[model samples]
Target: MVSEAQLRTIIAEAVPTIDAAKLPADVAFADSGIDSLDYAAILLALQERHGLVVPDEDLSRTASIAGILAYAAEHRSDA
Candidate 1:
């Protein structure tokens, strides 16, 4: 099973500027320098990693790493 820590690593890799070890889950993507295009790229990478399709509406609900972790926890098939 991919733990939240692992997910954090994946996310950090997607957004290279954000330091995963120091970032709290509640930190907003915008505050962390993750713009819309970066967010889209992160989503694409996450979808490929987790094998899950995130609808646009569903993606709208997530604005932080915590949100993505929650979505992955709920939808990841590899779990």
Candidate 2:
């Protein structure tokens, strides 16, 4: 399973300029300053890093870091 730390790291790498300390675990990608393009980038990065396919619907619904983590946990086996 992908841990919260790993998820945070992934998010950090995807948007290096963001202050991770201000990013809440439950903060949505949009709320954290990650727009549609950034979200797509994050999804692609996750797929490339873990060899898992994140559904577009799921990606669209990922509004917060917690949501993303939950999605990752759900798709961990596939990864």
Candidate 3:
């Protein structure tokens, strides 16, 4: 199972400006200056790294780190 900590690292890599450890889980990425492009890249990185199939309709729910963690928990593949 992929832990939340690993997800945090993935998020940190996708948005290089912010330190994931310092970021709160519930805060939106926009709070940290992440734009739409950054968010999209984050989604792409998650899909590529973890083989997660986050539908377009579901993408809005993943605007925050905690949200991403939740989505990954539900949809992550057993790779």
Best by lDDT: 3
Per TM-score, the best of the predicted structures is 3
* Two-way TM-score contest, 1 vs 2, winner: 2
- Runs off by more than 4 Å, candidate 3: 76-79
Quickly count the clashes in candidate 1: 0
Report the C-alpha lDDT of model 1 over 1-79, residue by residue, as the tens digit.
3466776777788778877767778888888878898788777776676665678888765678788777767766644
* TM-score, every prediction: 0.78, 0.79, 0.81
Candidate 3, residue 49: lDDT: 73
- What are the per-residue Cα lDDT tens digits for candidate 3 across 1-79? 3467877787788778878778888988888777888888877877777776678898788888888878777765631
Ranking by lDDT: 3, 1, 2
lDDT of 3 at 23: 81
Compute the lDDT of residue 53 as modeled in candidate 2.
77
What local distance difference test score does each model get? 0.74, 0.73, 0.77
Q: lDDT of model 3 at residue 68?
A: 81
